[model samples]
Target: MKMNIKSLYAICTAALLAGCTDLDVNIESQYTQYPINDIAVEAKNADVYFHLRDVFGRRYMEAMSLSSDEYTAVSYGGGWYDSGCYSHPSLHDFRTEDASIDWMPTVISGITKANTVIRDLGGEEAAPADIAPARAMRAFFTFIIMDCWGDVPILDYLPVTNDEVVRAPRAEVARWIESELLEIIPQLTDEVSDNTYGKPTKWMAEALLAKLYINWAVYTASSVEQYEAATAENEKLNDCIRICDDIIASGKFNLGSMPYAEKFGPDNGSQVEDFIYAMPYDTYTATGMQYGRARTWKNAGDVEKSYYGMKLSNSAGGYITMNPEFSRLFCLEGDIRNNSVIGDTVHVYDPNTYQPTSEIALDENGKPIVLTQTVSLEIPDDVQLGVGDNTKGYSQGYRSVKFFVIDDDYKNGRNQSNDLPIFRYADILLTKAEAIVRGGTATNGETAMSLFNQIREYAQAPLLATTPSLQDLLDERGREFFDENWRRNDMIRFGTFENEYGFHKKDFPTARFEKTCRIFPLHRDVLNTYPHWTQNPGY
Candidate 1:
């Protein structure tokens, strides 16, 4: 809940900062070289919580989304190709060298930082209650590591080339994550206030468990076939549901505090009551992501601004567009989500004055911007024309205005003023609904249908008459949480990730439906450092 507690971050000793990185080859020796016995938890956690934002940089989101059905980043002949990287993503033909999914170092750095906090606080076994957040944090980032790479070294200690750092089996990692989360839940504070705004708390830890259990089969599977064999009837489903029920029963987050549309915006802060954990990306203090800028519209002549007047900082041309086919379901009669899903018109706003009149964004000829729902891996020359030429390829995908980008930060630059949701109450509703429908026992008179209807009722979408099929819940998750980084995770869980969607063309088959495609190969750069590590299956 530490939504922007950068104010509390104090300068730490250089030795502490020196040991917080995973890639700093000398980090371990340096930490052992100078140990701190009196480091403050708040100061160390500031470094720990701040790095959480780095987990999702522009490239990571692009790869994960493109690999899923989220959206496409095609080559405008020469536009987004980036030395053939874009080509691989759409075809699902990723390489060990692709920059996409190349942020492992950043993730490891986060874990290393958390470990430093735990070590300084007293070591993991005997760390005091105050370091519960750090323990939970280690579990949190470790989950991300396990999710991306099947088997990874658990850097719980500073290994000076620990030369012995070995990969833990995926199942063991899962069990460790589950056990670690349980151990710290009771130790974490339940108070909800500015003090816990962006930090880990009891509910946040539970939410992490809910996420881990929801995708348990995928994370624990040794091979693609094993993951594919998993069903909604996963043994962990009940635990996922139980944890979700506990979080819900606490009465901490509810729909009454904020409407569906109001939860994602620059002002969705501590008062909204739906965020279980959201990253606070302050322009000055914490990490500010390029998400808003990457999603901002940059269609025509020098026109580069979001619906809320947040200027597009990336001059690189193409912004994220929703798949037209995927976007169609947002048209449900009473669903207000459609309004923010993708606007038919680009409501032009003055970049300076930041006020909206009736004007529209225009191309070079001063014509109103034109957009198409169609997309392809490589736009034909005739259709695409050229990059930034206002042709089909230049503006093919629909721009999503779901997260209203506003100039609410210090320079109106891209900042956490528009905080991103890591987990929301709405996700919990769908989580339980899916679990019950998947054959987990429903409790407290709550049927999968009733729980499913809760999300629909909140969105003003028509309620489903009965329990939804797995596909319905999956599609509904797409419609409700699009562009929020859950699409790829959802698709993998539902067994549809290998299917072609967005730009992942069906014919460019390098590894379609092959179980190995489920988990990505560790990038060559990573292996080059630790040559002993094994790549994921079939890479």
Candidate 2:
């Protein structure tokens, strides 16, 4: 069932209350009565869905984006920078006690909730439909945990003892994810209906499996020994190609033809080709998407209030603006994705007519305010690139509005109804192309060049005359998926994440690029809870 945010909230609140001291019940009885109750399996499933929403929400998006080259923390922007988490992330200086460490508990909560559903459904009275999605979500949560923190405790259910919380091998966790996704794909619903709109489906499983196999070598390798062994076999890339081919042959999705802005609009529910999985949001009932306020300037607030009737202050606390170099990837002449970046001439509207006026803002000195938008693909000259240093003014850098501010979404302030696309067919096509470029062969008349050309054609940008190199594909992904929360993974896979890029501050005393910083340190709280838990290297 498609559980809206409000309903899920109420369900989760009631579940928490049932296990509280006010109930006057024993701890064991409360656990049995609330979490594992046979009648509450559906409600538990709904809870799991809500947890997944939390997992992929705006906070997680901002965190991942800041860690990559796609964005640089604004020295004085308002959104995530105000929390002080952007400093370390922007400089590639993650600390064991950094504020981003909070994400671990949120991820663990989602995993625990999904595990509850699976345990409850394991009974004789279990429903296959419920078991399928629950298991898939569990794997999804597990994948995220391992992806971020490297080795993590793979909890079957909640841990009652410290030993139960010990970290599992990263390789084992990857294999578990692969096995779970493969086992659940056939059981997941094949059709896209309201019942499965924001939920896991067969296609999502296939896409996720493809993702795992493509990143197999990265996930399984920590030391030189493991790294050499992992790459010696092309089986992982071959498996990725096999899954991508299956998804393509299924004919369930295609590349979306809508304008880039409209693809993320409130009414984008019907657009099919691009979405493999999305987290549904509703301003009134289910809401957690907040990119409009985070990326737009405060000067544009009047426009937002006038057009959409929502009041959002300027992102003066550190808008997640793109590194000057990353912005250059777009063919500003024709690439539709460039629409998200506000440039030299912003549309000024007449108060009465609410139509564009032939006027621009002027500074106190009578000079016209220039919103210079540039993505510096070259390394920055100065190296002190942290908050409040080497920072640009509000409109200096190219700010992203990829998740467009629709009228209804603005009317509701930070809340939005646009479903966030987690995986889409466009990504699948790119995955297939990358797999083929890495040695796997194309299937069914689909060549890597053809897929690349299709995306370029849709954007009205120049097409390639020759096959693309791995670096070319990496740049293409930067332009196509900018601010879509995939840059970090893509950069890591391309082996460019640790390379010095635009506006990167040298905060680390040692070399600028530290290999251990790729995977974040385990949260201190988790280590304190489990004495046997070990931290990731270079913490």
Best by TM-score: 1
The lDDT values for all models are 0.69, 0.65
Candidate 2 achieves a global lDDT of: 0.65
The worst-scoring run of ten residues by lDDT in candidate 2 lies at 18-27
Clashes of 2: 17
For 17-93, candidate 1 gives per-residue lDDT tens digits of 54457644454354442233445556667677757575563666676666677666554556656655645654566
Q: Where does model 1 exceed 4 Å of error?
A: 1-6, 9-18, 23-39, 124-127, 229-233, 304-316, 348-361, 376-389, 407-416, 509-511
**Candidate 2 segments whose C-alpha is farther than 4 A from its true place:** 1-27, 30-42, 77-83, 123-127, 161-163, 224-234, 302-318, 348-369, 374-392, 406-408, 411-413, 505-511
As a TM-score, model 1 comes out at: 0.88
269-313: candidate 2 lDDT, tens digit per residue: 635557888877767666677766666553455333422223344
